[model samples]
Each structure stands twice: as structure tokens, then as C-alpha cells.
Target: MSKVVVASFVLCLLLLHQLASVEADDQMDRTAEAKSDVSEQKIDCKAACAARCRLASRQNLCHRACGTCCARCNCVPPGTSGNRDVCRCYATMTTHGGRLKCP
Candidate 1:
């Protein structure tokens, strides 16, 4: 009788541990999904800013303004630029590899 009780207790503990692990995994999945959503939003905001810059005649002001717009919209600043409005705006939106490479 004692042996049976011990076995049952062990089984219950194992089940509890498994449940905890599953809960942890679910929490991690939720976190990852939230991060993905934020990234998508940032990308969308950047694209919109790029479009605005394009329409503003290649002025650095447009691109610089776009970066600020992105920040207000909850995204990391793309970077700074010195070209005309169009090029600067494009760089601000697409400059991903650390620093801006000017021609």
C-alpha cells in the first residue's frame, strides 16, 4: 500500500512539472507574437514615411521629418542623411547596415 502511494505521488509531481513547462512555452510564444506585431507596425510606418519623402522633391527635410514621424509612430530612427530630400529620405528609411554609405 505504501509503495503504491509513493508511485502515485511521483506521477502527480511529474504531471505538474509538465504542466508548468507547457505554460512557460505558451508565454514565450505570446511574447514572440507581440514582438512580431510591433516590427510589422514599424515597417509600415517607415514605408509611409518613405512615400512622403518621395513626394517632397528629394529634400533632406522630408526625410529628416520622416524619421521624426517614425519615432512618433513608435519605431527606431532609421538614421541621419545629407543628400537632397529624396535620397536622404530613402536613406533614412532603408539605412540598415549600421552607417549611411554616401556616393
Candidate 2:
């Protein structure tokens, strides 16, 4: 191939490689952000449960049980309603005669 044609081809290849690398990085960033979001949600749920546990006067077994169940179940924060929350699982378990119910 002529020198000019070879140089042009090399440039195109470099551009394509850069684009692919950028796309890969973007995907990785998105995955990391999603993971971070989940972690934050878990922390928020735990905090909320702990606060509620501290405030309740009854100290019934159900309070701790509900908190534990909420921690274990999948939950999204409120305001983002329509998204799944741990309370739903607890409610389902209660309705279905499962072990985790408020006393």
C-alpha cells in the first residue's frame, strides 16, 4: 500500500480502539455506580430500622424480628415508591402465615 493509505488506515484503527475503550470504561462506571447505589440503600434501611427499634417502647420480639426481616429482604427507599421494599416481603410473609409477624 502507498504510505498515505497505510497512515490513514492506522489512524482509523486507533480511533476505533479509542472508541471501544471509552465504551468499556463507561460500562464499568455505570456498574460501579449501581453497586454503590445498592450499598447506600442497604445502609439507609439499616439506619432507619435501628432508629425505629430504639424509639419503640414495647420492645416486643416482633420489633426486632421485623427489623431483622427487613434487613434480610430486598428493599428500596421510600419516595421511590412502586419500587420493591422490604416491608412488602414482611407483609407478604404475615399474610401467608409465615413466621415473621408483628406481635
Candidate 3:
């Protein structure tokens, strides 16, 4: 009877440990999700557009258009030119003239 009691106690302890591990993992996942949400909403449009327009011939026009696109899309392609495939919103925006809006 005593041996059986010891075995049952050990099983309960193992189950408790497993439950704690699962809870910790769940908490970590929640934290990571929250961080990503915050980051997605806080992209620095100014810096991103500045980097994107660094090599433009018309600096003011490039910054203005890039800023608008970045503000609306919350993203900018990685370099000064091309690579619009990286940001669908930036690539697809149109001006009143039916031309591409972003530089």
C-alpha cells in the first residue's frame, strides 16, 4: 500500500511539472505575439522613406511620395530603387494621373 502511494505521488508531481511547462510556453507565445503587434504598428515611416529616396534625382518629390506611401502601407522596400515586390502596397499605389505614386 505504501509503495502504491509513493508511485501515485510521483505521477502527480510529473503531471504538475508538465502542466507548468505548458503554461510557461503559452505565456511566452502570448508575449511574442504582443511584441509583434506593437512593432507592426510602430514602423518608422520617415526613416524608411528617407533610406528609400536617398538616390532620387528629385529629393523633395521623392521624399513626399515615399512618405505618403510609407504612411499608408506601413512599409518600404529595402533599397533606394526597385525591389517593389517586397511591398505590394508601395508597388501598387497610383497617383491621380494613373502613374505609380511611390518613388
Candidate 4:
């Protein structure tokens, strides 16, 4: 009765403690994975952006947007005025209003 209740509460607390510890370990692993991905995914954003934006209608805005997209995705399509298929992620990303975000 009372003893059983106390035992169950203690067991539940121990289980919760174990779950929290596992969650913390999982978070640490995910953080490490993210760091590794960032290092591995670094790209020559300046050159990529310049190439992509060279013939754009709005050079300033194109350079800015292309640089941003290249940095995030580590890729830019070749001869990039309209060949966004080379980098599908960059091509598909959209603004809050559903407009294409990349240059």
C-alpha cells in the first residue's frame, strides 16, 4: 500500500533520470555532428557567387543573395543565370512569401 507507492515513485524517478541522461548524450552527439558538417561543407562562396551573379539583371542584389545561398548550401549551379538545376536545394529554397530566395 504505502510502501508499494513509495517504491513505485522511486522507480519512476530513476527511470526519468536515466531518460534525461540519454537525451543529454543524444544532444551532445547531434552537436558534434553539426560541427563536423559545417567544417566539411565549407565552399568558395565568393567565387561561386561572383560566377553566378556575373550576368544577373541586378548585380548587387544577385551577388548578395548568391553569396548567402552558396554559403548555406556549399553549391552554385554552373553558368548560373537560369540553370538552378545544378543546385536543387538552392533553387528550391523560398522566402517567407513563397518567392524563390536564391539568386
Which candidate would rank higher by lDDT, 1 or 3? 3
TM-score of each: 0.49, 0.46, 0.62, 0.58
lDDT of each: 0.60, 0.58, 0.92, 0.88
Residue 27 lDDT, candidate 4, scale 0-100 = 100
Instruction: Give the RMSD in angstroms, all C-alphas superposed, for model 1.
Output: 8.0
Q: Which pairs of residues clash in candidate 4, taking residues 3 or more apart in a chain or in different chains?
A: none
- Deviation (Å) of 84 in candidate 4: 1.8
Q: Pick the candidate with the highest lDDT.
A: 3
What is the Cα root-mean-square deviation between model 4 and the actual structure? 6.0
Q: Give one digit per residue, the lDDT tens place, for model 1 in 53-100.
A: 554665576667566645644443333433334444444443467654
Candidate 2's TM-score reads 0.46
> Candidate 3: which stretches are off by over 4 Å?
1-40
Clashes of 3: 0
Question: Which structure is stronger by TM-score: 1 or 2?
Answer: 1
Root-mean-square deviation of every model: 8.0, 5.9, 5.0, 6.0
Tell me the deviation in Å of residue 53 in model 3: 0.8
Assess the local accuracy of residue 13 in candidate 1 as a C-alpha lDDT between 0 and 100.
Answer: 100
